[model samples]
Target: MNKTDRLLAIVLELQRKEVVRAEDLATRFETSVRTIYRDIQALSEAGVPIIGAPGTGYSLMEGYFLPPISFTVQEAVSLLMGTDFIEQRFDDDYRVRAQAARGKIEVILPESVRNETSRVRKAIRLLISDKQVTPSKEKEYLEKIRRAILDERKISFHYVKKLADFDGNRHSVRTVSPYGLVLVQGSWMLVARCELRQDIRHFRLSRMTEFIALEERFERPAHFNLREYTPSDDRHLRVRLRFNQDIADKVKESNNHYIEDMEEHQDGLHVVLRVRQLDELLRWVLGWGADVIVLEPESFRNRIREEAQKMLKRY
Candidate 1:
């Protein structure tokens, strides 16, 4: 970035936080400490009230504030689209707040920029089908869960597992310390420390019933960071399958998430899927009928064979 842009960004960064270290600013701007020092010197010379301590970091002087910055047409459109998405996906409170925020943004923009942003937004629309929109019940649950997480409280609910046992037992009661919520593939999932399992678990809001936010408070772990957390891979099972070459394009178009890799082979298309259990891919493989063949894991092959045998008997 040019010196002018970098200077502006550094000031903005300082405005964002109470104090920022020179090393942090250097890393953020992809420059050296010397460059950052020079940039800070330039800002100070230009009459930006910057305070720097020897051991501590740099900060803007008390009560110092920058003038309102203007947004580009693209930036305005992006903000408008974000508000639209929140209005569609979030709860009623956020929907109203988003609408109000949109109004504020619209009022602040220049007339030409507003007109251009409106034209751009009209051409590019964010549309969600009725099925993709968050249901009313789920939105209500989201608000409750959000409050619980913020308040550091416990919540209890009846959860229905996606997979059922042989005896058709899939319901379980859970009490969890609410940590954070994640939106995955049009579904709201809660990542919490489950008291029943004594470990962190992900629960889909759609599968939860009898939800209640308990008054009992719990301490969330200080080290737990939702943005950096990744689910363990030790439980993943690798299942390899071969598909008829004729349907290779169709398989690719399906865009299944668990599919880790695919390779073209002389015999057919070699597809490898990583799932938590073999049954996850069983129904999908069976959907292709004779066109797909399970190529590995004797247990999975045997299960497929048994299922095919049952199907034949039924026929």
Candidate 2:
């Protein structure tokens, strides 16, 4: 079902049932609990009169009901189009659920409105990503961490660091009190108080394995705010790339965030980027294969070559 239809159905479902657990809603709708979480949030924002009990479920306020309501064709089209962002930004499971929600919206609309929505959908083309990053292998781990955060619980996990120091150690176990999840670039990082280090640290979810929630719960800091904890800033590495016409557009496509400047040159498109890590830049350059060349910062090119040789040796 489409998001709009699911939203409407959710209202009806709540009216019929006194209280419903998020897990039950996820099962009934064939969606992730997170998706149901967001849906409940959206419903509350729209003044659906939803009240929640910590462990039990969500229920409608005693004296509330949805008034008879319907949307115009234009309204439905606008709402459906907004789901594109949800599908683009979320994981595969959420995307599939969003698509199903769209189908539901279509099913409920009158024939004339449905036909219009379909026409609008077909005529308006949208492109999110040229390549979808493989769905994270750490999906289950992410859920565990999220549950811990919500429950004010401590979590223990085995983490593999991406960069090994001179000690040549890559693995360690950590016990942390999770703060919140943040999306850094395309990576999901957990901001937490590291019991091992005795400080707050950011751990990439992708690098985490063997996650477990401990029975011990930690008191959340009174002033802690996830948005304040994980912030985007302008300070970054300055680097440039020379892209051939064959993949100049692809280079532009990859980074809309830190792109400092783009110039059309006789050779191709020249891209200037302000970035955080050279490692990430090197990987992006490799993705373009022969079509892109590093223009300066000899250090980055050297690292890329060293990594390429390492790849060759491993193969």
TM-score of each: 0.92, 0.57
Q: In candidate 1, what are the lDDT values of residues 1-315, reduced to their tens digit?
A: 999889999999999999999999999999999999999999999999999999799999989999999999999999999999999999898999999999999999999999999999989989998879898899999999999999999999999998875688899999999899999878999999998889999999999899999999999899999999997775478899999999999999888878899999999999999988788788998999999999898899999999999999998
RMSD to the true structure for each prediction, in A, is 2.1, 11.3
Candidate number achieving the greatest TM-score relative to the actual structure = 1
Which residue pairs show backbone clashes in model 2? 1-100, 1-101, 1-102, 1-104, 2-101, 2-102, 2-104
For each candidate in the order shown, give its overall lDDT on alpha carbons. 0.93, 0.81
- Point out where model 1 deviates above 4 Å: 164-169
* Tens digit per residue, CA lDDT, model 2, 1-315: 999888888888899999999898889988899999899999999878899998999999998978866778888888788677556655566678889888777788889888888888898866645443424565556667778899999999899986664598879999999988876676678899998889888898888878888999999899988767645474478888888987777767776566789999898999898876676566667877778788878998888788889888999
Give the RMSD in angstroms, all C-alphas superposed, for model 1: 2.1
Candidate 1 has a TM-score of: 0.92
